[model samples]
Target: MRRRGLAFIIVALMLGMLLAALDQTIVSTALPTIVSDLGGLEELSWVVTGYLLASTVSTPLWGKLGDQFGRKYLFVTAIVIFLVGSALCGLSSSMGQLIAYRSLQGLGGGGLMVLAQAIVGDVVSARERGKYQGWFGGVFAVASVVGPLLGGLFVDHLSWHWVFYINLPLGAVALFVIVAGLPNDKSQTRHRIDFAGVVLLGGATSCLVLLTTWGGTTYPWSDPVILGLAGAAVVLLVAWAVAERRAREPVLPLELFRLRAFTMSSAVGFVVGFAMFGALTYLPLYLQAVHGVTPTLSGLHLLPMMAGMLTMSIISGQIISRTGKYRYLPITGTAFATVGLLMLSMLTEHSSLWTMSVDLLVLGMGLGMTMQVLVIIVQNAVDFKDLGVATSGVTFFRSIGGAFGVATLGSVFSSRLNDDLSRVLARTRLPPGFDPAQVQQDPTAIQRLPPELAADFLHVYADAIATVFKVAAPIMLVAFALTWLIPQQQLRETTKAADLGEGLGATSAERSSLAEVERGLVRLADADLRRGFYARLGSLAGLDGIAPQGVWIIARLDGKGWVEAAELACRADVSRATGRPYVDQLVERGLVERSDDEDRLRLTGEGRVAAGRLTRSSLESLRGLVADWGDSPQLKRLCERITPELLGARADRPR
Candidate 1:
């Protein structure tokens, strides 16, 4: 039953993932048709690139917001945005408008991937997560296969708008399952937000993306437009890195990178992304343009690639489950990918379809072996306190690398195609007024081209794609080499039982430490009335009315005729101790008077005055306290009637 629920959860998250994954592929199949209708070939790539740029920019914002509030609301909100974007996309009539709308879709798509993967990691243990992660490759396979099929169906019989329309229903289902079935996740709680660091990072990342998209395609590398952006990106990125080091709560945890293995692995993941995007983005184009197949047939040709993905993913998962060693998977996976890409470098317009399929299978096998494994490696190499940021940081860099690879590789392909087209045009005669700009900007121009010229132009496109692959293969080879640095540490096989003593029920040493803190004080008055003080004053109480000077002593000692016996006897007429004798009798009867020696045994003025005046320290000092206590002053006054009894009736009366 637990497994069943877990499986249901996995399926739900995959559905969210499919919304983004399918968009990437389905749109690719339908883009040519949309462009032909919209007639803006010059701006064709932006429809894809703009979405990526917007999505990448918003990724961290979603992650931070989720950390601040709850993940569930944001998850639901992300789906809503995606659905809205999809609706807007279907409504767009112009290429530029479509690109703008797709960016809105990218914003939500970005959140879905980051939070969906992060939320899964929260619930599942890394050891058991292998099977679920393998399910990602499964979704990737399904999306990869279905995207083109659905897009083809929509384009052939229905309107191409259905490609975008399809996302609304799927995304709605994903939103429902996530919002209704899943528990409200608190894994993203935070105390302080690094708003400053976020701003710096967003600015820096924006500059970098702009540089990547514009460099080598717009103006020159040294042009102010390119140089200024590139330089600003570098400066801001460095500044952001430094700022994060001092932050109490950093947007990106810099500490994980201090560990050499994780640092290298994250770098390797970024490089791995370069290879992943380079291949994934262009393979369909290769299958179509080079193989002379329609976009729909080309998507079917990718089945071997999907099979390769499933085969490697499941196999790697089972092996990791059995042996627990995981570090070597990425290292080996990148190696196979490099070798596969090397095989595909042999691709040509006339290359055999079977050969291309086999080559792609190898590439897919390599991807399956490696992609999800890097996330596990990153999580392992960091402290548990840093789990979310560290995990997101790794994904962040990978996304960055994909954007980098796509923009640069795409630009290169376009530039090279233009070069090839110009040369092909030069070789053949054309009308004197034929302008390249007009031809390049208009999709309708492709249909009007002379037969040989059309083939020439397409040949240039085929070579341009091959050129990117040639460049990309070497990059993959480098990534394969870097994977060697990935430590062969095993996936931790079990969720370690939680250490229950994280808070409050602390150890004895801690209790002792706390005790020392609370048990302290501030300085107080020096008057602590000592023993025998009252007894010392009793003798003086008896020596009264000797003289005016003598009276001073009487006044002084008049007070303490009333306290503890030891204090009363402190100066007791050496006689008072002998005769419980009415020391009371002497003082009250005035038979014996108090001393007159100045200051000889004087009490404080207030005490003397209180004793002599009240003949009762009893009524005034305690009057208010006792009145409230006993209901009335007279009743309170009566309560003290027991003093003689308290002093002892027999002792007080006769002796």
Candidate 2:
């Protein structure tokens, strides 16, 4: 494909990915206003939890279906569902309606995220995959930073519904680009849909999440509803296991748990999601209700944490990509997260925003370190056949953990606030018509009370939030310990730390083994391509005087054996006059020879020898990058497969 056309396709994919990632965080700052407008504070966590649960459960299904049926149409279908869901969410009149719509949106969001990333592997060459993957990470970082602030802007200026409505225009643009720029898919794989496993797993997960969300706050722990949910969760879990064992393709293969690395990473990822999303869900409430910050200002105050996460995630990914050492990251990351949670638990109404910002930054740093590292650890440990499932499995656990975390932590916050409110109200008198229950359901009701009464209510709110973090701190400690249990496996060249973007975005795209390795090598080989990297490869190939452009011409000749001089110029997007100099340079260096008509060029024996040398040099560079994989025949074949692309034409340079 032409470079401009390919770029458009990538842009479309990134837009799709951005829409899904943005939704995850955008609703956090809006939740306070949403609760105020919708009048169902008890169901507040469900807003985020519903989306998380639906997206999590649907991810693997989307992945498998895209594999069975080509991705092009499926990608379009996902965008349509997401946009429809977004429109419905904007029109919702109640919290219940909104939650339901958000789940529908999540179902589409899961497909958008997975298919978008997977399409990159399909459309882009292996050598450029790493570079594009890095761009995807940037998209996530932008979403994480901007989502909350954008949500707040919409809510404070317009109605809270605008938060969902905002996706409409973005989704339309992405849909247009994807349909116009993407080619029809030609590949398909046959596989069972695992309907039984998906149904049982979804049933069990919904039951478990509801149990956590409702057990104490909505109903007493001993209530029949709560007990029934518990019993149902257990029975469904057993049935799901049985179904998975018998299914031809389980939604989550049970055998993955046997790999200690997969098990440990999944566990740690779960806790990380628990603490991260739980805090994201509540911190805005604390800022808005207790500190009296506007929703927009509340989003601004959360920047410290987002900054820490983006910075540390990029830094850790770079370190691992370069040095291939990551065992320490998760352990230290969990330690920081635990400390950060404890710090957050210490906040009271009197705590300054600066203090809170510092605490959030610490927690964000911890989360950043562990989130992507766990993905890498699992990818490295799994066998080739399990690579896709294993990677998605880790992500699944983290997402489910977030769902449970928000629900469970919200329950704790609600229970603690109820108890505190009862104790304080029993000893004090309230203004006429001011019901204590009103304050529990609507935090904004505190502002309507007298100054002294509002102070007491704010203190109760602060205590409840602090207790939420307190409950999460120990869970993070368990993740810290699990990091120790993750065996230290050598990082493969096929999987680079730079893929932290996919991990950060929490996508569930499953790549084949060859695709995975190609992505890592392309990232390493092309890391410095813009800064004369081709020239460096030329020098490595013993072509000392060749410019990067000359290197391009030689590689073109090497790949095609011969090329019409005018055709080469046209492919390079340059005039024949401008491109002739590079071809002349290769000819002068005896790496190419003119055809009898002098209108075409082909590599000479010397040129072929230089091309062979370049191939070996490129392979050696990749081999060194994955030295831990050893010099086996399998490694050689993989390197051979990758070298041509690495030393092939540079799309950005003159041929």
Leading candidate by TM-score: 2
Per-residue lDDT tens digits of candidate 1, residues 1-655? 2556666677778888778767765776566567657866545556666666667667667766776787777888888988899999999989878988998998888777656755665555332333454455456556755766677677767787988898888788787777767777765456576777877887887687667666777767788998999889889989988999898878776777777667776676676666656565666656554454665666667667656765676676556656666778888888888888778777776678898889889987887787656655665555435655665566666666666666667777768777887897778777677766555554335446667656665566567777877887788777777777777653432211111110000000011111111110000000101222223223333333222222222332443453444444433333334534444343454433434531123344543542354223322322332322225433343334421111111111111
lDDT of 1 at 474: 80
By lDDT, the best candidate is: 2
Off by over 4 Å in 2: 528-551, 559-562, 570-582, 588-591, 595-599, 604-641, 651-655
Query: How many residue pairs collide in each prediction?
Result: 19, 1
RMSD of each: 26.7, 2.8
- Which regions in candidate 1 have their CA more than 4 angstroms from the true location? 1-14, 39-45, 114-141, 173-188, 431-451, 495-655
lDDT of 2: 0.85
**Global local distance difference test of model 1:** 0.59
What is candidate 1's CA lDDT for residue 352?
80
- 1-655 per-residue lDDT for model 2 (tens digits): 7789998899999999999999999999999888877888878999999889888888878888888999999999999999999999999999999999999999999899889988987898776777888888788899988888888898889978999998999899999998988998788878888888888898999999999988878888999999999999999999999999999877788989999999999999999889888988999999988988888999998888888888898899888988989899999999999999999999999999999999999999999998988989998998766776787788888888899999999899889988898899998887787677777777877777788889999999999999999999999998898899988877776666457566677556655554565567677677655567677888898889888787777776785666798887776778888877777888888889999887888999998888888778777777787565455565568778877875645554632
How much does candidate 1 score in TM-score? 0.66
